[model samples]
Target: MTNAIQKLYPSTKMSIVLAVILFTLMMPGYISQYSVFPIFIIIAFISGVGTKFLSAFIKSIFVLVLFIFVFQCFLIPSDTVIWSKGILTLYKEGLEASLLMTSKIIAISSSLIWFFLVTPIKDMMFALEKAGFSKKFTFVIYSTIQLIPQMKKLSQTILEAQKSRGIETEGSLMIRLKAFLPMLGPLVLSSIQQTEEKVLALEARAFSATVRKSSYYQMSKKPVDYLVISVIFIGFMIFVWWRFFK
Candidate 1:
């Protein structure tokens, strides 16, 4: 039951993500800050992406989030000091600013991970195509998303080769810097070569020809998908009214 519900329509998933982002952006302070987590947890559990979403979110944004908090605490000067020690001081307003920024970042990041976890690349492309996006544009978008992992793998391969050659990376900063020089060369070259090959392959398949591309993939929305989408839409409206008109 859970697994089935998790497999929602790509459009439905996209709607929820956009709605959450919109709400987070419009509502300031604690409302936006606190609302995201509960919403994310609920979506994650229902969609069976709890572990994956959490792991990805933390790994990707943990450093940035920490930096924001620390930077704001020390750098942003305020009259009302929350904590003080000689030259160091933490301001109340600065801390509040840090918390708000961190919350927005986390909410946006988690929502993105949730979208990718639940929607396959092919399905996303198909959905975009159905929504009147050009096939070539969708292909480019998909390839760009895929490029990150490919580059990571390439970097790992380069590091392994360096390790085999006795280039110490886990030693002093200078040694690691030396190792990075060799790794950087091959990684960039290989990425460029891969891009060229992909371009050639696409050209060979008449990708640039003025012809309609036939898609084998199809996506359909169920009643649940509709219900979820409608709810998200209503939520967005209510948020706007409360934030502005009301």
Candidate 2:
């Protein structure tokens, strides 16, 4: 995202608008689960091209989808049996429910993560502002984008530290639950430490006191920006009409 994006999007606003359009298109009704495959292929290319941690990024998506599927298996209330071979008779409705939930979860997550990778946070926030979104809401979006990576790293660090400290995660479920508390302790502490560092850095840089700070890379809209915006707007209107009236 840092090094790869070089005016591929005419401006920050365009990239964000494109991202939102992709997000809407990936939904279940706007596009079916089967058709989402093509969108994901494009997403894979975009994320691969934009993000630096290609392996981890790709792996995270698989993990995310798998987790959603497994969670669905437990949470979905279905009566249809899955299998009738040997001693196994799985519920068909459960399987359908799991697949449906998994499709939605995976598509939504992939679309969002791909967008974050391909579009810079600054560009996204500015785009939201240009699109008439309130600054307060946009600020939340910006801060969340900035903090998620830090929180992910801190989570991994905590998990690894618990593993190294012999937390007995391989034991019974009860023991694992007990171990979770201690692991959460370190995660909390590290998160607090990171927040403090962010505060100090903000203060040192006079982050909010002075106004009219200049950006090093200004994003002036190009002809492509208008084209992309128009397409997205037209597409959105079509979708809304189809959803509400058709």
Q: What lDDT would each prediction earn against the true structure?
A: 0.83, 0.61
Task: Give TM per candidate.
Answer: 0.80, 0.55
Worst 10 residues of 1 by lDDT: 1-10
Candidate 2 to native Cα RMSD, angstroms: 6.6
Give lDDT tens digits, candidate 2, residues 167-230: 7777789998998889888778877788788888877986666454444545666776677677
Superposed Cα deviation of residue 147, candidate 2 (Å): 9.5
What's model 1's lDDT at 41?
70
Candidate 2 structure lDDT: 0.61
Tell me model 1's lDDT, rounded to 2 decimals.
0.83
